[model samples]
Target: MSVMVAVPDSAEGALALTSAIAEARLLGTDVLAVNLGLRPISPEHLMSGETRITILERTHHESHAEVVLHALAEHPETERLVIGVKRRSKVGKALIGSVSQTLLLEADVPILAVKLPH
Candidate 1:
């Protein structure tokens, strides 16, 4: 089994990636990271040369949440999914749909939702 993480273009995404790496180490598995951001993620910079990381580029047609869900479906060996979340008010969430929330509700596998350090 492997740990899957959604890497967006935010600090929370970076934190989630780091957390996924640690969890993968504990689980003795590799990491599958779906790149949902425009910026490229360098495996050498984030990884410690221990766990192998596979980066999957997202297609423009799908939303970030959709891409992650599709990845989960494509890779059944994924043991867990890690995603970055931000604190949002009820009103804000109502106004703008949340990808993390959608994943939490829809994903079949266990989820690790992380936020930026205070």
Candidate 2:
């Protein structure tokens, strides 16, 4: 079993990556960290030894949500998906579509939405 993690460029993304690593360690599964932007992941963020982390960088012009959904489809071994979700109000959500919300609705496997600590 594998866990696919979407690592965006935000505090919530950091939390999601860290949490995904921990979950992978506990489950003895590998982590596929998909970076969907131009910014590369810092060295500190790549500190997982128990489970191997395969980083897939996609700097294309596609939307982050689309990239994540594509990765989910590409990786059939992924049993669960981990992503960061910010608390958005109803109006905020309606105004701006959230990637996490989209994945939650569209993903075929189980999804874990991690949020930043208060």
Candidate 3:
């Protein structure tokens, strides 16, 4: 099985990737980093060492949560899902909704929501 992480074009997403890499290392599994954003995901974003990483890129045609949910369904071997949660006020969260929240509810696998360091 492998770890699946969604790498958005944001610093918070980079933090999620890092956390997923650490988890993969601890579990001795491969990592699948999905980039569904418009911009290219940089190699520098992957700061982990000595781990197998597969990068999957796609257009932002669907919602982020939809893309991740689709990935989870496609990758049966995925141990869990990892994503970043930006600190948002209750109003912000209510107004914007949340991708992490959607995945936490929809994904069949375990979901790890990582937050950026303060």
* Top candidate when judged by TM-score against the true structure: 2
Give a tens-digit lDDT track for model 3, residues 47-70.
678888888776448898998888
Candidate number with greatest lDDT: 1
TM of each candidate vs. truth: 0.92, 0.93, 0.92
lDDT of each: 0.90, 0.87, 0.86
> In model 2, where do residues sit more than 4 Å from their true spots?
none
**Residue-level lDDT for 107 in candidate 3:** 90
What tens-digit string does per-residue lDDT give for candidate 2 at 1-118?
8989999889888888999999898888999999975689878998887679999898567778889888888899998899999987889988988788788999899988888767
Better of 2 and 3 by TM-score: 2
Report each candidate's C-alpha RMSD, comma-separated, in the order given.
1.4, 1.2, 1.4
Tell how far residue 14 is off in model 1, in angstroms: 0.6
Clashes of 1: 0
Between 1 and 3, whose lDDT is larger? 1
Measured with C-alpha atoms, the lDDT of residue 69 in candidate 1 is 95
